[model samples]
Target chain A: MPVPNRPDRLFRHARSEAIFIASFWLACTVYCCAYCYMYGYITPSRPLTERDVKPIWGVPSWVFWGVFVPWLVCGIVNVVFSAWFVADDDLGEERAAPIADPGGTEADVA
Target chain B: MRDIWRDVLSTGGTRAESAVIFAAEVGSEPKALVALVVFTIASLGLGVAANRFVGREAGFLKKYFLGNRSLGAFAVALTAAVMSGGTFLGFPAFVYAYGWITALWIGSYMVAPLTVLGVMGKRIGRMARRTGAITLPDLFRERFGSPTLGLITSVLVMFFLTCNLIPQFKAGGVIMKKVLPAAATDWATSPPSDDLDIKVDLDTGYMIGLTIFTATVTAYTAYGGFLAAVWTDVFQSVVMAIGVLILLPLSLWSAGGLAAATARGVHDAGIGYAFGPGAGRSFHPITLAVSFFFMWAITSMGQPSTLVRLMAFRDTRTLRYSMIYLTIYNFIIYVPLILIFIAARSVVPGLSKPDEAMPSLVIKLANPYVAGLIMAAPYGAVMSTVSGFLLIIASGLTRDVYQRFLRPHASEKEIALMGHVATVGVGLVVALVALRPPEFLQLIIIFSSAGMAAAFLVPALMGVYWRRATAAGAIAASLAGSGVVIALYALGMLPIEGTIAARLLPANPDIGPASSFRPYYLLGFDPCVWGLASSLVAGIAVSLFTKPPDEARLSLVFDDGPAVEPKFDPPKREVESRGSEEPEAPAEPSATERRNE
Candidate 1:
């Protein structure tokens, strides 16, 4: 059996990370969309009043809970994942310089 | 995000007509002009400084086009996040039209940084380094060893990018025309102190504004290349953040508070505005909600402009840091924007042109000079996006076209010069097009964005991650993706009367029969979902049936062994050779690497 190498490992790492992040995204979408659609989508026939529209910190209840709270949590999750969870693998060296004579420019190409 | 301007107004007219009419009414603001001029001058200065930085680098082509893959975290995050003119103009207009529901409409954007960077960043960055690829098409061509794929990718990128640029140039001109002094033009009649009474012919003003907009943006982009664009984007992002932060408190204060604003907004536009499905049933059912999430996250990964940023970051550390920065930045800009525009419903009520909400509220809330600075947020958006597009188009022309096919033996200096010329040439063409621009500005933006994403996303994802993906598969995927999007749009424009198709998918009456350029939302989901699905299927089926990619090429691009780190200070002779010839080939693979391949 061939030994798994850097490319294979990196691919596996990227795939696993992608799946995790996508799952988090799915969770946020379900909670926020379902919550807003259920609570926020009221019938127009019913008259709306200042009292009837429940608000927290000046934002509507659906917006506060569905959008803002999930948004805040997503931000926290993103920070944690980006800072700690996401690996810092070596990106590899840039391509070698050309084969030629001695004195020239092009110092910091990469 | 599917079509931000499709239903921008609850009334009947389009975004273009509303803009023209609004410009006719609101005369010029002198202080705003001064503020804009100051910002433009500063941007020009940055371009000059960036040119100096590029001049010192070795490979002018790589440095000019990809910043020598040296972008830091802040530059990467800001340039990636500060998308385009729509973020400020179309989005606020969207919020104005559809109350608080705009929150959920744009909510999926929260995952944008993660989705775009985390998934593709490391893979693309590594691939580019290994293949010595500077542009998106370069990566594809190098990986597959197929110049045909390169040419096709180039054509698609250039075509879609130009489509994207025309509307942005038009937007910049419209904003400037909105502020043109009534008495400045010969065909103007100045009224009393009341600005509402003032009326002027906007033809001359529009031309002047477009000319200035074209000159400033084109000059900076052509002069300094990629570094200039990225640095300017960083500067513009700061300006955008400041603009939003300043507007937040003032808008809230003007509307009494968020509570007061929400209450009044409900009173004015109805409770439907504050909730889902919107007042006009805009976000109906559930498919659209899911489609929008896909639009922002999945499609963003496909954009050449955003993908290029991934290839240029200095290290994985930069990528990680940028993700955090982008998350914070999105929250600061978007959440505040949702609050401010919600408040605008109460403060600047009964706006005929909903797209004018941002400027209208700014003028009403802040002083003239301050309003100009705040207006810079949108103007900066236009400039930053235009500059980025110019770089991509120019790189596609010079690197992907001229050097690759026409002049494969061309010298480094010749290619560098061509790069600058191409940037200017594309800008000139786009500016001329903007002079007699199509009526539907927003639709063009929508098409270009979706088309680019559709054409490139699946092929790109497979190329980087899937070992079995073939050149034929990528080509098939690209053609299928672009074809599907165009066909849907074409079918949407046709008069499908008395046909099964007509019954199945009818025209959106709001946009009218002849004028409706929107795609038929199959099952209420955006056309992009269909396009992507088609692309993915074609890529997989074609790859499975056709021969797999060449093993040698695959090994070259995806060798699994530990990379031989290049010495920062190469032997003097090697440095001299770099100037004279092509880069030296990478070291031969180890035994373990070959076994894995």
Candidate 2:
């Protein structure tokens, strides 16, 4: 029987998955740049308190929109990625190696 | 016994004199001291237990060095995630200094778990098993079929990790000193110079802390090896997590709230602390933010100690679990740190040194028991980091240097003896080097961590993924990256001055403003970025020029999933294991050094 080319599938999945996470990072970076450079009310150069008071989700506009919001998005993205990410594509081999670990031999804490 | 112990660690001044000076400097806080001592004793106890546990294992080298590759998900996550000094002390210190720009520095950390666990973890683990490799250099050597590569990589790792150890040692000393009650000299104000006989005593405090901390960690690590390190790391990580988790809410409450903290900052520092890079803002030229994000991610991914944790985990299941929990742990540690330290500025308004900000703020804000626990937090960080490095250095010495070069035919008993010796010896040398600490904790860390990542990043990744990654190419990349960093430190604008090497190198030529030409910082890039670029260029260019690594050679290690090889199997005839009876042909009988059963 011919061995299936599963590495190809695994590679594609891995690459796309990486891109999925990186897109979030790059998106945040772009948003930060726009928040600082494009916005009218806030500037990185001057003191931030000068801005007219605006709050989002119980945080000031300058912070809520710029920093903490992106972090919240990252947390959610990671949760989804962890719970449902594609991992360990089947190579269709009947007896693939069991990925053995020398687990209990040295330091098994009860 | 007390006098003997004091004399052994003495630095000219008497303990009584030092105590008096300490008294004058600050008030006493015994609760913090008691907390630190409890944590310290616990660390030493874990080390002792782990050493005994490892002694009975099948192979001394494999079991002691890699914990027999038996780590659970929780152990792996905690040990790897607790990047002691950097996360606990240096990170908070850096943020306290630069305000909201800390977010900019650590932004890429959002994707770090994804990048590290997803991108590198499985591949490195699979590779380690394929070659029966227990260390980073072993992987490089086996994959590339080059002893020269192994030797060079080992030397670079040891040298740079020693450089990395300095900041940790300094931070450990600083935290210890911070908690000690002020040295009440009882001398009058403006006493005469001879009559005063006074010293700043930070160095004295640092020396004492360094000796005790180093002694405890080094002893345990030398005894138990990687098992001891990981066991203690699990515990240390808990202490840090608990300490921080408890302190943040309490600190916010103590200082009123975020709004109140900002109000205080505006009143005193004349700028918004919570939302902006105030008057003393360090976020200039914008590129720094991007650079720091790259640094933490790259440095973390490439650190030898961190990579070892990846290889040592039980399986892919463990890797997945670690990824999830470490992400959550990082969120708990890092986000709260930014909030607490920003709030801390309200309490510690005139902190002259940025690094001292964490300890000072905790002392002021936290209740006695909580303050003590939090005070031990940074020490926990430093010890965990130090333990990891100590083990790696031992592995490098025993596996790469001693067995491969000096005694390829050495017995198991001999290698084990040497392994313990080298672990202790390396720890001692690092402690000595750390005695005279640098001015900025994070800057030196950047130079070392960044340089290390630049050197190993391409070689490590390409060697894993790229089938055509030649030994020559990997060599070129490692050389190009590390070589650039060293040259820059010697000739370019290094932070520390008054060196003999500085006198020898050509005086830095009068250059125009930073915009026109940044010689010291070439194109506004750190040595790390410069090194990374050079390595990429060199690795690619050299591989194209050189002969490709053999197809059979590539077939052994170049796989997407777990390698389909048994842990103790012999190399198939066509592929050829490098265990022949010569240096050039580099092979030997697998005696007691097989991976643990």
Candidate 3:
């Protein structure tokens, strides 16, 4: 009794969503790895505050690679996701439901 | 963590070295003061002018609360200027004091635009439009048909957001103290030494700044509402950017380039501030770093003031443009800031108080007029944030409480007047509390905002995308999440000196056993992780067992099936398919209408 929609034909919504989430988190994991290996693994496991690390360019090495650059990449990826991937199904004309009745009984008010 | 840093930052530094060489105060202050006065007046003038354009007939509450749901990308972008003030000031201060690991705490801000708008804006904007929900709690009430849930949300957001506002007031005071040190009261005359046992006099500049900030924000927002607030934000954003652009190159130039500055300034090299083992040697513990990383990356979406912008955009394209523009803006403002603060370590070395790093650097490097321009930027940031929150509190008071509970049949005239009255009242309360701030400005900010995010994150997202999410689930999730956060905050506030737990934290004699902020990483984890966990579990568990929302309402919010969220964790209910694909039994008429009738 369910109504078929155009989006379902392109791919399973669940499957597409699953792949996207997996890939995004995977990239995040990759970024974390980049931070650890390149920046030095003195994080959760090592817990060492190596006071002798110098900057690559103007920024510290781990910060440039681990924090700043990775953040840039993540931001760009999120921007792309925002533009192309987001759908307006709930917001579109099909679902432009009217506001709840203003004069509704008191129970609905508070 | 809160009490440790709070006491240390506010009282003095671990090693508050006197300034090696204090720069003579710049003489161009009069010119800069003129510019600041003019700019402030112009902003107020603009606020009053915008009021004429708002048609009062469309229900002033609606027009005021949501700009009549007609915000463009530019308005949305300016509304984000709050990131400029306290963060801009506090971030650099932290960097100057702690060194490299501070990068991780603020570095997470780069993703803020992406999470705030790109992810949450378009969807929530559309949802708010469709459902006629203005405030965040209204979305919950209508979407889930739970007024009780709505009321609880209002109380929770109001509590934490008020806590969040304290920092902005303090930030305003910080800026004032830096620019007009003369304005500071008698107590600030002989500045206190970097001793934990001694209490410093309240800065005269701060008192003046807070008064000015509170008065201006309350005035414009009270008169013009959301649009005025957004418009002022736009102006503030421009001022902030100009200040940073001017200050960035100069600060870098003063520091003798990044390489020299880093080498000369960081005596211990590598900053010793990584998030793993041996961090006692550095500025960070790995546990804290990881917590901060996740916190900033995700929490921006949960802020009610920021999220409300989603409810007002003109259309989907506006949301898109706002995202794109915000990303670019963040880069423009934040990148240089990172460089500027690092350079500050050299330009103005050995300050007893690091929070004065930026303001002090500007006075030393730039002319008085330029300093004023730069000083105004953070003030802009704080004003935008404070005004936005003031409006939110006002809207909450008038619509959620008065209109909903006390005056269900109140006339429009009463509603409009109440809106203005509530804004002033809220502003006054916040300013009064700020007169005697409890801890470091940044510490209070982190506590309040993080708590808000934890409390609302699960419930807001679930209400939007999940079909099976029930009112009971939402109520349970919100209560549980906030409960954990408050409990953790309370525990952190406890005086735990002489206890075995004290071994976990760094030693500071000033706080004695009264600081319960130790034990931040019990079992090697943070409370935020636990708060989030409890929220999700409670929401998912209660909703699955309880009756789902009406099939109609569910279909409306997550139409055409294939919800974006559940794709991560595939829904167990096959009955919840979208667009009638293998539909389950037709749902009973939900309380949406029956309860109304």
Candidate 4:
């Protein structure tokens, strides 16, 4: 009942993982870039003054929110997903074969 | 203190000019040089030990190139997330000049580990084991049964990887030059007297350093192989972390607390230091922010080096643990660098060269002994990166080109010999070229990294996931991707909007020309994005029009055949059959073969 010419369950796990990660990355990208450009970016016509940017724990408020906070959050997301959500597929054999002679060319036995 | 921002505005000079000026202040104390020497010796010992471990193992090519596919979680994470000298040297230079805007420039690294591993780790590992692939090109060639495709990949890998090494070599020389005796570097620091009969001043220190750096890296890489590269990467990763972590506190203390430093930095460089489109309009326009986000995450996913590490891990557990460790590693290294360098801006106000920022600040704040170890961080990174790249080039020539085509019946010893020879040969060539390095070494590094990502990312993704992918499609994808990026670089050499070539790619609009050569960021997006887009379009479109790949091959990769023994024991005939350069005959009674039976 399986669809023909599609990746098996093992490969599908990797594909799904890739899709999920990509979506998370897209979200982070949007938040960081949008926030930075909106608040941090300065121009002549729409200029920002020193008062407009405030220090938060030594970093500019814009950077604290736009980059630092998201970076911390993304790091957490990576940890959670990798530890819990990511799939664990059978990675096949541990060792191919032992070298019969340590002195000899190992590829000869392959 | 020199006001770098005001200089850029008034003199119409680029930040790069300031970089050249900083190269003059090169000499360091004896303790730092001694520390660098000790680090080098330890790395060399590790390399020899790795070689012995590899020699005692099975399958010289497999053990040497792929470490017999037995790396653990920590080794995988460190090697995969290995940072080049740019992370310490060139990147900090940008931060010193551009300020907090650089945070966004490198922001996407937060997800770099996830993207690099999550995208294709399991699938690529599965395919490599199933097909008995030792190298990246080997994976492609074996999967599609196309020697031509394999050969093209080999050439491209060699070309880009070789280009990638030049800057690293130069960085190694530059760092070594800094640690040389002041007497030797007198020419660099002081002008020759008019009373002298002949004003003969050459950078003797740099030459000596270049020779020493090149010999050390090449010898270890050629002597050992992949195992050496990975082990050294782990060691270097720890050293780099310690170096930066130590520098952070010292720098903050020197600048009188983080808040005061941040305030002073903004006051010194103007509000631009703490804002986007930073001082002198560098990293300008919103599109660039978007472009850099793609450049870091997506482009990194496509790197062959990352792919090679993915292929070598033990299992899913290794993958899972590596992702976890790398998240911690990334946060520890990258986040601190931004703050450390920002604090450094306040501590050392008028640095001649931004590229020299890390070393300059380290010496100024830390004592002679501590400064030496901090310097080791960057120097060790250079050695690890160079050695890693050398092995990749060696693998390309040895497995993909020589054994596969030139001498298919070569003995195991001959194959082993070729790997060593190729590594040394490539190392010497890159070192020789690096002696007279190009003006803009960092830009060249960026181009090569982007070029590799553009060339390999799409074809590789399609190859792993798409059962319908044909050899032609992959070949087209690679060529189109490489072509678009190369063409744009060539176009950038032209005078855009009737301006001179030198001014074409300024990082800051106010600065006349920062670099001699720059990539044409079309529509404010990097060439890598355009190249990647083209490759994806070409790969999918070409495959749709072409004949589907051989049904048997598709089943081998995509189907869930009757669970047989692990693909550990490949028969002798399959190994011999690689020499034929033909569509491989069924090596095992695999899914397709068994179904027919």
Candidate number with the higher lDDT (2 or 3): 3
After superposing candidate 3, which stretches have Cα over 4 Å from the reference?
A1-26, A41-55, A75-110, B1-32, B55-57, B170-212, B268-282, B432-444, B496-519, B524-526, B560-597
What lDDT tens digits, residue by residue, belong to model 2 across residues B195-313?
11222233555566567767777887887778888987788678778878887887688777766665565465555344443234433334444454455555567777778887788
lDDT of each: 0.72, 0.61, 0.61, 0.72
Candidate 1 docking classification: acceptable
Q: Just chain B of model 4: what TM-score?
A: 0.85
In terms of lDDT, model 3 sits at: 0.61
Q: Write the per-residue lDDT of candidate 1 for residues B190-286, one digit (tens) a residue.
A: 2222111112223676677788888999998889889888987888688868878998998888888888777676676666676766654554445
CAPRI grade, predicted model 2: incorrect
What TM-score does each of the candidates earn?
Answer: 0.86, 0.78, 0.79, 0.85
In candidate 3, position B264 carries an lDDT of: 53
Best by DockQ: 4
In candidate 4, position B14 carries an lDDT of 22
Per-prediction DockQ scores?
A: 0.37, 0.16, 0.27, 0.38
The lowest-lDDT stretch of 10 consecutive residues in candidate 3 chain B is B14-23
Model 1 is docked with a DockQ of 0.37
Candidate 3 C-alpha lDDT tens digits along B474-551: 998888876777666555667668876567665432211123343244433455766777888999999999975655
Winner on TM-score between 2 and 4 is 4
Docking class of 4: acceptable
Which regions of candidate 2 fall more than 4 Å away from where they truly are?
Answer: A1-25, A33-49, A52-58, A89-110, B1-28, B52-57, B166-211, B270-278, B348-354, B432-444, B488-519, B560-597
Q: Is the docking of candidate 3 incorrect, acceptable, medium or high quality?
A: acceptable
Span of 10 residues, lowest total lDDT, candidate 1 chain A: A98-107
